[model samples]
Target chain A: MSAIATPLAREPVLSLRGVNKRFGAVQALTDVHIDVAAGEVVALVGDNGAGKSTLVKVIAGVYQPDSGDIRFSGINVTVGGPGEAQALGIATVFQDLALCDNLDVVANLFLGREDLAGGLLNEVKMEKEAWRLLRTLSAKIPSVRIPIAALSGGQRQTVAIARSLVGDPKVVMLDEPTAALGVAQTAEVLNMIERLREHGLGVILISHNMADVQAVADRIVVLRLGRNAAEFRVEEATTDQLVAAITGASDNVVAARAERRRTDGAEAQLEEGNSDG
Target chain B: MADTEQTHTVADDLADERLIRVQGLSGLVHMTWNRLRSGELGSLPVVVGLVVISILFYAMEPRFLSSRSLVSITQFAAPIGIIALGIVLVLLLGQIDLSVGSVSGLAAAGMAVLVVRHGYSELVGIMAALTVGLLIGAVYAVLHNRLGVPSFVFSLAGLLGFQGLLLYVLGRQGTINLPSGSFLVEFTRFKFVTGLTSYVLVLAVVAVFLATQLWGIRTRTRAGLSAPGQGAVLIKVGLLAVGLLVLTWYVNLDRGWSYLWLFFVFLVVVMDLLLRRTRWGRHVFAVGGNEEAARRSGVKVGRIYFTVFASCSMLAAVGGLLAAGLQTSVSQASGTTDTNLTAIAAAVIGGTSLFGGRGSAYSAMLGIIVLQAIQSGLNMVGVDSSVRFMVTGGVLLLAVAIDSVSRRARSSSGRG
Candidate 1:
């Protein structure tokens, strides 16, 4: 049940060690180490500008880190660009979802990597594959034939996740998938993450919502500023500890306010006791 | 597979209670109604407009609906319709190429000069002209893809400059007459698919349509999906066959099916296939819908833009070559008189959206016929060019209004 005892037991499918990135005057990431094992959900949680996004981008190959050892399935490799990353079995679903609204769900699912049967788009094959993928995720949507613009935020998120699976990647990374989702939609996405784990895929979930992270994640990694602040197993992590780790100080604004209220109440009780005596 | 089917009671599409499913023609009507409400008014408005225009013209002139006039409309529609096809492709990307007219004129002028002055073979001249068109498109692609020049601005500059180039190519002669017995003239001016050839073409088209529809149904059924009913498929096939039969009968009454019009239709059909069935076509729509999304999804946005611009110019050249062959001459005024507007307006009037990502090549074919019909009908009624321009302008405005209104409706209805 201990975080360190179990994580080191399995050979990680995707691992990053000593990853460092800098943007001219600002150091975006420093000494970042993340390992996502097969069938494990590792939640990367942080406040704004805490290098969570930078770490995801570096992994997704949008921006190469200055120095890092990235090993996929125990083989050291360099992700040159998005295409190369996809080729190396690393799928990234960005926050925007990057879907064409005018196209159908099946079309969006198999957009760049369309299935062709005689050098022409085999709609039947693609549609069948789309259905199979959705069924695996147990997605609730009216029809894949319907345009994406006709979908709810949750269904759209499901389609985006389903699209990432089309390439059969070893590691799938989702960036704030539940950020713009409603309660039910967020539940659907979290359920989808569980399904992804069931399918034996390593998942890196970058989120700001603590409840969401705690609900589905196996372990939570907190980033403060440009460094890893703390790591907690989901079973043991609390909101207070996570918040403190995210802000890098326990006596920050929220904690200080609570401390003041407690002292004021104790003083008022002492005054009452003296008057009674 | 049988065991897999037991878990789900209905097909994937039929699982939604929101959709009101029906059978046969009622299903089609219901689907169309839903689509219209959601602003998916594809080609319906244009088809209705064409009918209304025909009826109005017939009411005004007794000979407006004559077979002879109908034949003439199809023949005259071919050249500009070809140019309009290119415009449809460009418009699908929500971009414009205002220089199509000038480019067409320049190509025609270039080809005619090569044949008459240089004594080159007509084929050589045509190749050279098409090559020039390709070069112009590449220049546009470079300026657009690299320098980030808006297509409208560069094409507008091309509109004036290419016209000057056409004039310079003609060089004091102002006009060049293509050799009368050349392959280009013979193919464009006098050739036709008469009697058996016409019937065979009509029958072949209908057969292909039926085959494809049946194949689609089979595949959909095998995939355990909700398929279109057989009755609906038959109805569509029957309507197409009847339409083609009627059109062929009318054309045969005059000069049979014109080879030029056949070529135009062939190009339209091919373009349709390319747009609907290829990865490139899908990328085009995606790029048009959301460039950022398309780019992020790993679509080569620059290459798509380049291909679109280049194809547009090439099609414009083909239209110019056809026009030259039909007229037997190329003058300085060759693509200058109403060519640009007619081509662009035909595309818009046919149902291609100016906002992009929502059009087809068939729109060009239908749109050109509509415009040509209006022009011929107006000519028969003795209207001046000034009046014609105003009428066309009004129609263009109406079409754009429909597009914008439907766009808002679609967005409001969550189908944007």
Candidate 2:
């Protein structure tokens, strides 16, 4: 199993080669090479501003990278915008979800691409498709016709995921799928990710929770200082090793721990000062 | 070694999550129902004011409930009600159409000229009037959408400009008396089924509406579409039916039914269908809800804006034609300043939210009935016209206050 986990073993559905993204003078992403293969769950993890978001946005076609090539199914493609990316079967579920709160789940699911019949919206057809998507995801919501405002946090996430699958995308990227959820809700979302993999879909799950990553991820990729720092199979990696790789302290871990202690002390002092005023 | 335990844990967690979500949705529905039953339907205060005004009118004249007086009230309300319908659409999109009065005036003038001055047939004249009104509306929509100007400013400008153009069209003639025996008069006067017949028709139409809504809910539920619970759907339909029956009983007590009122009601229902069931209607709601979001969703927001403005103008034209039929003439002073404000007030008072994405054309009828009832009732009791303005303004303010308060409550309860 470990021998077959190498990059050369499987063809990648989406691949980014040495992508570099800069915002004016700040380099947001540098020399990032990542690949998402079909039927695989790749966990992208990093601390804040480590270029994880930048890399995902590039793949989602929100921004054009300053340099590097993006390949889709082995064909080099230039994705112009979100619409173009959607056409190419690449769906990104942003943290905000981009859902209309006033609209019901069915309406939101078929919002831009509603089914039509006889020059009018075929409500029946859209409703059927929305139901199918929800059922396939094993979403336990009571009904799909209720407004999103009435949905719980986890159900809302399910709707967002279902929306992404509506276009039958080759890749689905979830940004912080369980960020604000409670324990049970997190587990539900994890189950959903597993279902997506079972359906032979490529998924890129971005999260700050190590527990969540361990539960769902097949492979773990760490980003540090806008660069790929380390890659490891979830079965062979431990939480401590992953932490060390993320913080650039894998070698001489004890000295790195001492330095982190000093920084924590200064950060706490600054936070206290701000709160006091 | 831990696979079985993990699977069991996952199953338990999924069940718990489902329970929480179900609880949340039920709570939301319960809160919304409580608010609606408590008279927090956006214009609760105005509705109360209407009831008070009716009571006062009844006290002044026992004849207020008489069939003849009731007929007069509905007759006067017909044209204004039609205009109010258009206003409701604009308000639903969180917009205003100030040009309705002018659009009405121009349409009346055009119809009169085409029939009386140009010696054309009345049917041709009516068609021409509607077409012209639609054209004007389209132009306004284009201007508003393409230029990205606020609807109020452009529509206000249209009010003045169109009024001037109407006066020009009616040049030298000032007022043109319509032929009494013409098709326009016959069409307006045409009444199918007398008193009981009218009441029955109204009831039937209301029944059809309720049935369709219920059927839609049931079909959606069967398809596993997200729908309100069966109880909620039943409650909504029951409330709507009761309201419709009450209004029908009142209107039918007097003159059976005003053909004019029925015509306007038909127009409003068609417009509602256009907004709620069609692609164009969906686009309008989307643009109104969040312009940026709608644009990103691939809707041509600009084109929708144009279409809304144009449709509003067309509705105004229809109102104008109706007014001309009632008066049997087109006058230069046909559309007063009060006309525009009253139409807008009717929409707002009919439960159409000023915040957009939440209203219906039925609001126009409700709003116009409330306002016109007050006007006619006051006239019967010999109240000064000036005092009527103060009362209407007061009602408007009270409605707005109720709207704001209810909105706050909805948001706080996490149900809005």
Candidate 3:
């Protein structure tokens, strides 16, 4: 059930408050608070091992937060396990995609949730549903019966994202869905993210590609050293600002040394644009 | 295929989904070529290997392909074939039951002792032996789930421990002869379907296969989903019928078709259906393919592992019982000598991937036959166990190497 009483739809679909996680001596995440409203796309960006994945896992219920209150639809809920997280209408497409290569597209699409008729797999119905899902995304898969091993990276990603829809979740978290994808495939995935937004579902996109993030994300949340570094409105934030936040360039020794050069570089870019005009 | 969408009457826009149904003979051929080029070998390698090996063996020894030789070879494959089915299921999950050989032997030993020494009826003794298998499986599952002991280690322990238990139960005799008039012995030894019955059964199989295929096409087509054409269905059903009839005729040429071997094949077929056409089978492949993914998807990983391990042991028990029935006795070497290697080798050779989530139940049948043929042919050529063991091991390696190489070829070709 969603909180639909508010006409403005400003209430966050999912909100994390002071969440913290530790793996022994290493604090993977700390005091991480992020919120997403319905129909909003939130981009999570971080360098390698900045705890973006750890935070995603916590939200997805793969790892329970050490101390935090996770509120979904303005209600506090305990994410004890992935099952509970899924039951709470949060669907996650992890970084690995997690598809069985030996199984065909239909099998992969309906892995845990298969429709059975008379105690046997209703392949006909499932296959039909599979085609419908693929068509909705305009996915160009050749066949639904071929094993997942035969699918391209884009098709596999589509299958994983489409599988998440089988549950019709409110919050959809995609962990680097465009990683290792070609240009066209990346565009296809971006279109899917926009589609999720159009469907009035909260979309969480975790990515390393700044171009992809700035292209589709409404708001970007950057993580640095297990903490929230900065948040930016996509319309106003410059690439340099995003990069500065990601690399913590404000106080970095090398970044400070290049600060005057950065200003000069910006003026030089304006002169170049003037000459071009 | 896209053109067909337009040509075909529009029943529902929702049902008008795209399927790569290549029409005409050439298009079908083109599709198959694409699959083969991508390393979707399926039973191709086994069929080719069977032919090559059969020819080479026949050239070396004229009696290699004789009907009588084939009969004995098939009989030899029955028990291991049944055992290999369990291996296929376990391998699909990327797990193993190293204790299967010992488990089977223990079951036979237990059955013989209870029936011959304690004078229990054969049925009760057999059930008791199978129940022991179930309990042993549960123990393995518990050790795996609760103690965090890996299946390989636990089954390794079971292998040694079960073999010791078998020896201890025999109590210095080390062997027990099954009763001659016992139903178990008699049934396994002389039970064969008459040729008439076998042909009828083959017809029934063909009929059911065709009916299902037609029904599937009808359902999908009616639902506005793309379905295989009637032409393709007929072709597939035709090939299957011809293959079954040829196999039935070949086996019947000997001592008719053994009902026991049919039973083994039946189990494999049923398991194939369960693995391919049921939700549980999909879960098995999912859990085996990626345990973490399966868990995140809400699949009960522990339960899947438990059921596979338990069913594997149960099948091993039945395989052991069949072996005992074949010899009419349980001995120290009943499950000892070559059963373990042969059964595992059969599975691998039949194109089942050792890496898991990539095997079929029917591979058990194909792989076992190839293995038994090698052993039988080597016997005909006066090759001793030294050569037999070496050859079998070499063949297993070859199969695995081929599997890996083809997998690489597939990846390089951008199939994944």
Best by lDDT: 1
Per-residue CA lDDT of model 1 for B299-403, tens digit only, reads 899999989999999999999999998899999899984899999999998899898888899999988998898899899999998898899999899988998
Model 1, residue pairs in steric clash: none
What's model 2's TM-score? 0.80
Return the DockQ of model 3: 0.42
**First chain of model 3: TM-score?**
0.87
Q: Is candidate 1 or candidate 3 better by TM-score?
A: 1
Q: On residues A1-277, what C-alpha lDDT tens digit does candidate 1 reach at each position? A: 1134245679999999999999999999999898889999999998899999899988989999999899999999999999999999899999999999889998899988888889899998898889889988988887788789989999999999999999999899999999999998999999999999999999999998989999999888888888888888888887878888888788798788878999999999999999999
**RMSD (Å) of each candidate, 1 decimal:** 3.2, 6.8, 4.5
DockQ values per model = 0.65, 0.21, 0.42
State the lDDT of candidate 3 residue by residue for A1-88, as single tens digits.
1111222349899999999999999999989989999999999998888899999989988898899999999999999878788889
How many residue pairs collide in each prediction? 0, 7, 1
Error of 3 at B65 (Å): 3.7
> Which scores higher on DockQ, 1 or 2?
1
Clashing pairs in 3: B15-B224
lDDT of 3 by residue, B310-348 (tens): 998999999999899999999999787478767778888
What is the lDDT, from 0 to 100, of the residue A21 in candidate 2?
Answer: 94
**Residue B6 CA displacement from its true place in model 2, Å:** 23
TM-score of chain B of each: 0.96, 0.84, 0.94
Better of 1 and 2 by TM-score: 1
